[model samples]
Target: MPLFGQAAVDQLLEVLDLEQVDAAAFVGESPQTGAQRVFGGQVAGQALVAAGRTVERDRFVHSLHGYFVRPGDPTEPIRFQVETIRDGRSFSVRRSTAQQHGKTIFFMSASFQVREEGLDHHSPAPLDDVPGPDDVPTMLDWVQRYPSRAGIFASAPQAVDVRYVGVPGWVPPGDRVASEEQRVWMRINGTLPDDPLIHACALTYASDLSLLDSVLSVHGEVWGPGGVIGASLDHALWLHRPFRADEWFLYDCTSPSASGSRGLAMGRMFTRDGRHIASAGQEGLLRRIGERKQ
Candidate 1:
């Protein structure tokens, strides 16, 4: 298999690095992919970056909740506005908002905390139960095998290595559906800086990529054409343990319910050695059109 190359990875990092126009205000630009709307992950990550920039270096983000207020325009620059909520001795809270053309596109409230010893008991990940990342096929490989099924994942320069445990929702009705149980092994395609905030921000970006896929899998649905169409409405994340985004981690996701044209999915992140690191959840607007869905 060919390598994804560091070029794409570098591009991701650059995107995360925002320009500080003023205190508590930052400007960010999107990749010129020429997509219809800005990716939800990019805006979320950028909002986090803006919030992280205003806080002291000692504190690290532990949790974040964000809402996609409006669709973003990729061709325009996003302005991030951050407000200091509170900064206690052990904890700090910040609110970050992303605006395009003076209108809010995304908003996030993040909490940061200092390291403190605490009781820890987390269930081990099923590493032995599933195949290692090396044993699975890459997104490029999946696209190669199912060109008809590959939607936007068809190109190269993949920044993150996403290896699905089984067939993804994008695949037509298959032997197994990930919606019942969606797990993917992923990591940055290249090494990242040693900054904890950067790692957290990068993972924040990756977290949004597939959380919604589980909802699609619930009905064995695919994207585009006759499949179900959806848009993420909100996202939430919590970091329980430290982790490096450049290393391999497993995202085990599942959908609790799908009603009123809305679907909810939750996921947990675990290190390869089975340490539970983080948890992520999202809800989206899903609508089925055409005869393929029925």
Candidate 2:
């Protein structure tokens, strides 16, 4: 089986290391993961890391809004420019732009706040009596069973270990129609340094995975050889509490709406112990094409 081992996780951590080019300007590199375009989650996470690097440690990121301006070229390095929008006593706002080949490819706005006691409340955890990661089918198991159909996944350098709770939506449907909801258990493949930003960035990378797949489930669009075509248009995330990305987290995802060649999916992240930690939403371009003739 292909390994998403310690080396892979370290490679991701290395990708987040940014170099300061000038005042408020930083440089980041894309890992050669053999993807056609840069992963949107990587850009979002790096931008947030850059923004956080410029702020005080006591202030943590509470929320972020980002747009995918253009598909990034994975072969080249990206430059991040951060703008300090505000720095009040309790809140700081920052804007980050990622540029490559002299063009803007992505941008994001993030807000950070100093920790304080507040009236805390959250929606009930959606997961119930679900099997844990050890009991689920890992991505490698799927790839091994249907190599011709899921070969592309095997080629990518995966930094996170993913175990789907049920058959993936992208798998060619048999008697069952695709489901509206999807669940997966995932965690960073290896231990990370004790840094909250690292954990946040790791989760940020994991967030983009399978979000649009929820949309695919609704349309019965499997991914491979002229299947569904899609790209994330915009993504938003709210961090509710501190959590370790290296530990197992259940990602419960669902597609609530699809219209005009677009789909909206939301996900809630919960610890194995059922602590609701974060919420995410994304809208993506989703279209179907005719099956390929072999």
Q: What is the per-residue lDDT of model 1 for residues 1-294, given as tens digits with 9 covering 90 to 100? A: 233647888888888999999999999998876468988988999999999999899999999999999999989999999999999999999999999988999999999999999898998787788898999888877888878877567643478889998776677545444448788999998989899999999899999988988988777777666677888999999999889999999999999999988899999999988999999999998887653442
Cα deviation at 176, candidate 2, in Å, is 6.1
> Model 1: clashing residue pairs?
none
For candidate 1, the 10 contiguous residues with the lowest summed lDDT are 170-179
Q: List the residue pairs that clash in candidate 2.
A: none
**Residue-wise C-alpha lDDT for candidate 2, range 130-237, written one tens digit per residue:** 788999899888878777777547777678898888666557555225777878898999999898888888888899987777777776667655576678999999
Q: Pairing residues by index, what is the TM-score of model 2?
A: 0.94
Reference-based TM-score, model 1 = 0.94
Model 1's lDDT to the true fold? 0.87
Model 2: lDDT to the true structure: 0.85
